[model samples]
Target chain A: MLIPFIFISACGADNANESEWRTLDLNNTVLLTLPQGKVVIELAPQFSPKHVEQFSSLVQKSFYDGTKFYRVIDGFVAQGGPKDGSEQDKSVPLLAMEGQFSTDGKAPFTLVQRDDLFAKKTGFKEGFAVATNNSKSGWLTHCPGVLAMARSNEADSASSHFYFVIGQAPRYLDKIMTIFGRVVYGMNHIQAIQRTTVIDGEYAVDSREHTPIISMKLMADVPKKDRIIIEVENTESASFAERLVKRRARASEFFYKKPPPVLDVCQVPIRSRLVKLQD
Target chain B: MLIPFIFISACGADNANESEWRTLDLNNTVLLTLPQGKVVIELAPQFSPKHVEQFSSLVQKSFYDGTKFYRVIDGFVAQGGPKDGSEQDKSVPLLAMEGQFSTDGKAPFTLVQRDDLFAKKTGFKEGFAVATNNSKSGWLTHCPGVLAMARSNEADSASSHFYFVIGQAPRYLDKIMTIFGRVVYGMNHIQAIQRTTVIDGEYAVDSREHTPIISMKLMADVPKKDRIIIEVENTESASFAERLVKRRARASEFFYKKPPPVLDVCQVPIRSRLVKLQD
Candidate 1:
């Protein structure tokens, strides 16, 4: 009775060619330094240009320095930003909603599931999980590690406050929230962020328990000697396509009961690696 | 530009009658005490009889006391048990696989989604998320807080070690693994458990970083003064059905961009509350 717990083998990237990987752009990459570790985020400026621009400008200005993850709901999201009613906060303008955008059939979309519960189709595009309706319009799915803007009751009211999907994929918030980026590396640190303990159905608002954000800076702003180089598997590459096929097939001997030959967009592992440029 | 974040209002349990809730039976309840807090688990003996019996017997003998959650993978599972190859550990019998069970149409099921990616139908039964193949055979889904048995490559090798789904629902393992119970209360404590940091694609195997389990006990064996009363919303109740309808509708004013009129089985909330019997 040898009970050796086994995990499904992750797709190997060792055999992948250099063309299968794409180095993250310094202009769009953000280095979010928390108390635990550095969380690397890659912004999708092509999808939500305004939101990415706003977030990048804030990073450049050190607007997120000394902020706290104020509202963290377990199995839902971890939202954080400067909530102080300062003059700078008052000056930030509210941008119009960019929840979903119309897409041509030309985007490098790799299909994962044709029959998703929330949309007509679900897949990955530019390393982001996406859902589309009739291949005409698409929006990023609310998978774990997704970075989206938080808003009030009004639709077009997202400003500086942002949230990370830290648990199960809240697909209900798919087309409603504006998703602009995702954590390409150090998702473990995001999960390790201290959660706000809700006592008797009431959220603890005493910010003392919240995890602090030491600083957030764009990779371009960081000194050349201190940057961590990140490279992600290109979703459009042939090697990635092959890996997706292998995942859907589950051809390993470990699986005594083969699962359905359908892949959830969130389950698709977009592999990434971090290289420290200097000591 | 007031960025006030708003959350979807949870289904109200205040208006429901007492009949709509089901008080858990003490015989099948387990209280797993961790350093952070106590987690209340409701075992489903009807699904996996052998596994439940084995687990109950172990709880009575304090087999899980002082065990460390050695393999806590972020966004995956927290696997832990006494791996210290003692004579008692070698004496445990290997149990046959009870991954799924046949079902008649008589089971009290509340339909949540008709089109799930992995199953023909998905819904809730006896307060647990379930997926069925043509309403004939069903298995528990691997949603967050689900307690399941861990085994090796061989299907029927599970004995003493167990794991809990701590993050996104891994639907692929739904039918392959045997799910015996779910965390009905204090899931926050489960989410707050220390995670094993994987450095450079290698998992840290140090035992010191793992969270230690204080003890596990059956609620029935505990004295009346120490028991915590747990009541879960009945999935078969009319109020719960109505709540599911409201969740699918997104009729609240807060949702300016109403989501699709479909629900993911994992997104449905099965509310529970804890009542301390003594101070």
Candidate 2:
């Protein structure tokens, strides 16, 4: 069962050092080729060791080059890592869910929130789903664009199947799964697809249907000129904090409604600029 | 402008009452047919009057039959109400943004989460974009799955163009545009669509080169058995309170770190179940 986590802090365009903005490293990026467009995700090796290890190794081996984001729950998540591939891919045994989140140490851009007071828990933000609790330290945070391994009913069931948080923070799925990285760009590409009715036959279908994923690739594999340049607003920048606070406080003339005093970490509007890198 | 309002409520399902279950009126349900599958959207007249008038009238006239959910934002929204239509239907005169949320003494749900505490907005639950400040009044609520009118940057620019919330709640767009209705069923269908990207240009280029929606339609206009069946869990249920509290608890094995103790209405999950009506 997925548990919804409170957004830690959402401050967009609020803070910025003089030179905080930077472009993505395409050499280390993976291109999620969807039917509509290609989604470029820059993995984070700085967060977790084991989690990133599995992700990098798999991506290098072309593990998710063709998997589809099969399950998409609005205000929640869009999952893609697929084990439903070739006989060999499926033949590879799934890995146990990595427990990386720990609550002991302090990290950057990290804030902690819990529904109940007694329930002591905290972690860093990978994006939205990859979180780490110091109680037993690892890496993973549930922020938008954060990617994690998808699993079934068991905590140890996570594998190549991965997903993205496209909605509110579903922190409930936290300790139970392994979250690895986040999408620094191309989130809109995944956000704007059409949907399908319940696969459940007549609202109560039988067996699961085998969905097909055509192809996926890494930008590094493509020619440098072919790459689309993109840059994300630095998280620690004052501008990002300002943008978020203004958004949470109400900036548009259309919003006659006064919003709550705070913003959810998942609700933060992180901006990404199209970096036109010329030859 | 699009505003997302993701609400996260605790399940507290233990206190849920069977009596709270309410079936949707078949006559009022709109079945959306797409190549992917069938989507059922129940328009709520309780939210917006002016927008619903134009919407239902359009549905009856088959305005959206061949329309597609043009722009989809993966965890945010799937918008398809476009003023631009195919040669067959042609575009209809856009509807002006009617500030009707200022209604006095609106229908009351057992659960009370005051908008005055947050934003002064409300909308049609069946099929309308409404806004309201229960204390002051009511109109369009940016809850998830809501089908709203799409307009230009102008205040009253929304014509027949519309969109649906597929991901996080975009509350920033509230009150600026007119919300027509919401999708009550088969949200998964619209949520599963693959997102599109810019093909011709490298950066933000011509808007037309952007992905275009194929078409959209009401399911009632399609095959009989293909219609998707859905059941929305009562938000006012006892389980809701529990879910609300637990959701805030953030007690999990994975959270190596936790943010803080905070919760927002938009972060809440709107529970649902699939059911096929017996002939």
Candidate 3:
């Protein structure tokens, strides 16, 4: 039972408290309170400005306070925000889906410099797992913990509903969905959300297992004393680059043979931590 | 509400019923009846002969009939076996870890021909995700749905406990753990297993929420009439190679631009179906 744990524990301990972690901005973050724990999401406004703006407004307005994770597919995604057939966002304008950013050589880049199967140039930019053509546009990828708007069949039908990727990185969703933010902390809480068992192709959720969102709010809306501060490893830092290399070909006592030489950007871990603010 | 669903369904429908699926061997498969549904696992003797043999013997002896999935990490693994910690295999000698296989030029190979970051060469041989150095040895990969043995800190400490990968491919565990089989069907049931909520760092599982295994039995042990036949896409078939290419650069109505021109073997869809037997 402890086999992989011991191996992972050793690999995870090296940079547990590295000083290179960059504190996130409260104004640009959202906090989701669940029965289990608190999940902090660092909003990505750089990639999808409209979607981020709408999401923050919805959060501030408490639009998602009591909504249940209506549809959760295990090894796939946990979706929420105004249950099915809900009328909470009827007045809200349907926002056009924003999936990619103009790459036209103007966007800031943190080159992962690896061959990616999903994008021509893959790396982190503005605190999001990003991929680009390296010339025209880039987009926030559908990696685990990514936050994206849930819409109907129409490309511009996205409104209040959103989902978080809680399973394998569904990269095919890239350039197709509007990824506005990502859960930075409490991934366990996201993983702990109840899963609906699919009978045939439809999933049935029991009300007893429904883990409702206690509240959703922008961190900025909360008082300074009550706000929880989080810091993420700066993707552009040299330490981050070194971490990527180490992850590609990890050589520990447990590993008699080294792993392959290539790495996908999604495999590059972005470590985050909770900390107390200095008075 | 339908954002990712619309995006995924279109991508999933193209090859839903292609005539490229290969039927699995009932003799080498195990059926795990869960509350959600029946999960069928195909044992891989070619990859980990000792582990698979031991596992089958234990299953036939009813060692895991009443065991609960004691440790389940969301987006990771569901580990289960004899929770009583009782000695079920006292008579059987503890088997040595069989993590990798001889990758010498003489070994059978099915080349994926992709630049994988985890292995020098990766492919499927005898119905398992395999990775190797191309000259020395290969091991089963930690792709989702893979079943592997669990052990202590010691490299040779594995015994009866086993786990299944239910989320993202934990490729880092490739050579560190012994992968003996893979879930050929009912993956949705595996994903629906209860998740332990980690409060702080400790996981808490509720007795009522715990999903117990109804029973475990090998398909060979059951009557032929009760057997469920599953056919997976042959990895070495021409159709599979063509599917891999289509997955890399899909250009459909949903996909405004062509996807990146690279495909991870893990991303390639291995289509499976339940076909009626020819009378």
Candidate 4:
């Protein structure tokens, strides 16, 4: 009889002290309501200021309401925006890609692994999976639940359309796409979104079968009484570093044969919880 | 406008010659029928012979019919088997864990990357993602769609319960669990299966909410007229190696900034397609 062990202990019990947890900035958080459930996304202005600004602006104006996830590929990404471009504000200029940025060595980086397959160093920065080159340039990794701007062949083409990674970490897209946020809650809802069928080597483009986004609103704009509070483990906190160390060591008694003492940056869990507001 | 490009080119066009695609062995292939769709799995007898034999025997006896995916954790694994142990045959003795094998240096291997975070070397063998230590001991990597046996605290306790990797590659379980097969087709269906919500850091244990398995049958037991043909690219084939090289180089014009040449073995696509039988 399998005991149903918590496979990835990263998402396990909330053992960290309250001080180690940081409540999400309501202004930077987006409440994306889908037909299934609400997905809470935390925008990363430090890495992708223009993208975050544009996305927040679009959300405030209800541009994403009733938009369908036009392109949802299993094991890749779920892209959603105005399907017919009728709802999009064409006047808003397409922003140049904010894919990667030079990081000062002092930036709060809790290292997860060195010599990553996609980058020289991999870790968590401000609750987002991050990869860096020679401790200089850093970009958000395409881990599951990452929010990135989708673009065409041109590097600077991204504007309103964005995607959420719904499957494996597509490291190949790490530096190529502009990632601006991560899902703090309701990742299961993102995974539950209907996927587009691929026929004859191409994704089915039928918008009718796709999942629809009911509406997207900045948490700051939502009424406090109706808002769902989300708090994530501060990646820079000492307790978080201890969690990473414990994961790497795999010191649990459940393992009959302990695996190698190494962990993928994407596998590191940044824990989040929904808090009920007091009366 | 986002071009909606084939993000993971591994699942893209069937450009390989007919000879490069190997038809699955009917005896080793299992056809799992879900209400949503059908999933085709290829059993790796070369690795875990006893586990495969037990699974195939159970499948032929209709042991997996009506079994529920009791423990489905998003971004981890989908576990399934006799929930109440009513259909399971208790006469069969519990088998020792066959988690890894000693591979001779002559074993056909198509290397994807060396110095993998979890393993010394990572590659593909017999159309399955694999990792090996010093080219001696080899085990199947727990990439998405891999079929592995689940057990309790004791490593050798695995009997009939098994799991499918549903999300990111959980490399930590590479050598700790017995991996006997992989999903060759219909991974989308597997991903689409209903997920058990985790309330307060614990997966919901109510089996009623889990997705039920309609039936599981060995392809060999099915009538020829009803069997679906599945062909996977032979990892050892030259064309397959060429495809890997092209992927590593990522010389596509679509890449504005070419990512690192390194490729994760789990990311390497072993293409499979369903073929209609000629009337």
Candidate 5:
């Protein structure tokens, strides 16, 4: 229940030169500061287009300005986008549900082939989780801190009632939902909300789980000095690959047992580091 | 994100009868009552030998009689352990960590291998997690509600202070840690705990996050009829497999768009029913 320790080894490999890092454009960045910590999200317009568009519009309109994180799962993810205060206050009609799984589980001899819902999967690529087949049709994946649209039976239901994936990859919903962006920094902030209510029997959708975002805006709208520099763990870099391999196999002496063979994309972590960058 | 509504075309099937149902004896059940609702966990002894053995012994001794579900993560998991409330609480020196990841990312092939403190990947079989290769031998995995030993640098440092997997699978820690048992039920109770503390700049020897579990006890120790009755979603059943596959693909019209192309073992849900069987 607690990620009490974020064991950061003395990798000591970070470049002291700031120019090496990139500053996320405010236009694409969403700062989510909750009780546990602060989380910044970088929307992926390339993946869920309509959702991204909707999110961008919401940011501009300040729709999430005073909303609460509302939900958080330790070691999982903290989610925001719901209005704060009370659920009794009805603002807009529930958002219409849209966005469908874009990938085709064509790979033969796999878990999906054996299961119906898993016939397909979703994952992150270049920070944008997309569901792709050899056909190249994809959507955003639901990794930790990924911002997504909350919908119902009707399509186009994303009206900022969003959620973040918290615990174990709920891949059963893969290819069946829409993911918009990921938390580029401060996911811990989202991991500390209190419970509120239950939705069906699933994790009761609680409003008290997390503190509201207070306000949300595209980094472009914030002052330039407020911008924070961040670096994505180069999943392609040798260091990144080594970390991945190590994560997949555990480099710690603590491991006397091993896990199953293959690594699923959803289980992989696309980490981002926060730093102060100045040219 | 909302889970797609699963419209059971039940063929209006005769719901399920005795042959289709398996009742958990109060004597064998662990009763966890939460503020919102109660959850019942069906223990799997095949996976965690030491922890299970310890848990059973403690249950017999009424170890967790008044323990509170101290930690709760929305999507991740809530963990309840550590004999709380005693003026002077001493740590329970648990056995050494078990389960080894394969040396070549092979044996536990089902386990999504990663790079960390060890070497290898393994997968899930029979609902428990294990990893292995030519040179190592052991068992342990991270499944939602999995009771695991919370240890320091020394592999044997785990004490009564334990943890659980609440949200999306964090398989990165597999095999590197020791998994004791899983929450067959009462997840909501644990998931409802308020994470009042924010980890600041990290703490060691397992700091603030190691909240206390008020107390716990096996139902058998309670009054005869006062005991709780629970049922686990039979994983070995055809219905369970059907649910997993059917839920995964989102083949129904409901899934206008899906997220990923795969599913992990932790996301596999196990339903609980509160019905008693006459002795």
Candidate 6:
């Protein structure tokens, strides 16, 4: 949906100016350079270490470059990777389920709510949306922009194909798909990919509609001058907590009346912005 | 975002076979015949009476005949109405804020959750998502496929433009926008509209991408022979509650592990299907 341009621009500026933010480690970041722009994704190894490792390895091997977003369901997910199954390397063993919560839950954990309807507890761990029944382990959520491995009916089938949440949080898929990362920048570019019409139950994007992945490179591989430095709001910080409260009971000038007094973690603003590295 | 075809087709069949359902009132229904197919929207006058009246009146007058979905944000909303503001008929007075809870403790209300994060109480009333702080009144929610009146910053400026939520349940818009109806049939048709790309901070759709509205007419206005009969699942039914439980702890064959133990109101399926009206 077309959000009011003013609202988005204002939010973008506010996020760019956040006082307390953490720069994403280059080793854990990947850049997807599309025709529209570059999208930077931060891999969450703490949640899905194996999936992260495999995804990064694939990136370094240039597995996804030139791949097309084969299946994009409006308000659902943008799935891209190998579609013909020709790229499947049988040697890359299929990974077991890595979707369930498995975090240390120590620092950088900002508990959003304790009584979340979707889980025993819901919060942000490190820089990703998380939900779990215990502090020992939690799964990454399916919020918009989340990167998750797509699998068939088999639990161990997730190997190459990955889908990104582009709509409402499909919490039902929380423990079913391995969420590995999130797009932190150039979401607009991703959102701008032209919709491909489905025909006779077949998801076929015409050659003209294909949004080609120009390249997928880990930040560490990019030259220092070419790398786009970014910092995400420390989700566990006090400022973030304050911001979450304000969003839940928004008293903004445009709001006719105060909205609901609570917010889902997805509704909370976890901002990311490009930053120039200090020389 | 694209969904697995098998999963979607399976869900489609399940939704189409609801045993206990309610046929939409012709007087309170509007059909949007597009290039792809027809979308049936059930108007909720009880929620926003004035907005519904105005919208239906505009439909009857053929105000939306050739309009295009001007602004469509993937995983957000699809907004469409008169763009040129030249169609404004001064006779139609501007609508006041009719967007808050206005119902009494009611029988049709199936309370989904008492501790809803978005509101004091949340549930479904007459097959539409509703939320209220008190037992006396509740407003329609911004669930997927919800039809809402859009306006500028002014609360009372809602006149012509309207939008359909095609993504996540944006609860932040709950008491803010006037949600007057919902799409009860042909959601797939609505979801099929090609997404317009955002260029230079503006929503732009190439002529090739535009999904033109062939016509929009109230069901009452359509000839009896041409009417497309459809029925939506009764939200207040016991079967719906059972379905909600199954969704929360989904043990389906596809699920690697059972997901969370709770269901958000939007997560619960409200099925709709084609039906033949007994002569």
Best by lDDT: 1
lDDT digits (tens) for residues B83-201 of candidate 1: 74777666678878888977875553677888678877788888999988775788889998999988878898888889998877888888888999999887777876777656343
The sequence of per-residue lDDT tens digits that candidate 6 reaches over residues B92-178 is: 567887878645455437777766677766778778888777767777888888999888788898888888987678878877789
Q: In candidate 5, residue B99 scores what lDDT?
A: 40
Quote the true-contact fraction of every model: 0.54, 0.20, 0.18, 0.53, 0.28, 0.44
Residue ranges of candidate 4 with Cα displaced over 4 Å: A1-18, A84-91, A197-205, A277-279, B1-18, B84-92, B197-206, B223-226, B277-279
Q: Score the docking of each candidate (DockQ).
A: 0.39, 0.17, 0.19, 0.37, 0.19, 0.26
- lDDT by residue (A199-266, candidate 6, tens digit) is 22233557667777899999999988778788888875567777777776677778866664656777
TM-score of each: 0.88, 0.66, 0.72, 0.88, 0.62, 0.72
DockQ of 3: 0.19
lDDT of 4 by residue, A145-264 (tens): 999988878999887888999877889988889999999887888987887756333335576878999889999998888687888888877788899889988888778778778888
Cα lDDT, model 3, residue A25: 80
Give the winner by DockQ: 1
Clashes of 2: 164
lDDT tens readout by residue for model 2, A1-279: 223222222222332343346566665567665665556676665544466666667766777665655666555667666546667357445676654544355443434333211123332242332233343454454656777777665666665677777665555455456666677666765654333224333442322432334445556676677665667666555454566557656766555445445444454545556655433
After best superposition, candidate 5 residue A159: deviation in angstroms? Answer: 4.7
lDDT of 3 by residue, A50-126 (tens): 99898888888898898888788666788887756656758577998798888766745677755555667788875
Query: How would the docking of model 4 be graded?
Result: acceptable
True-vs-predicted CA distance for residue B14, candidate 6, Å: 21
Superior by lDDT: candidate 1 or candidate 4: 1
Tens-digit per-residue lDDT, A17-96, candidate 5: 22322445567777654544556788766556667777787778777776765555443445566544345224534443
Which CAPRI category fits model 1? Answer: acceptable
Better of 1 and 6 by DockQ: 1
- Residue B153 accuracy (lDDT) in model 1: 86
Model 4 shows how many backbone clashes? 0
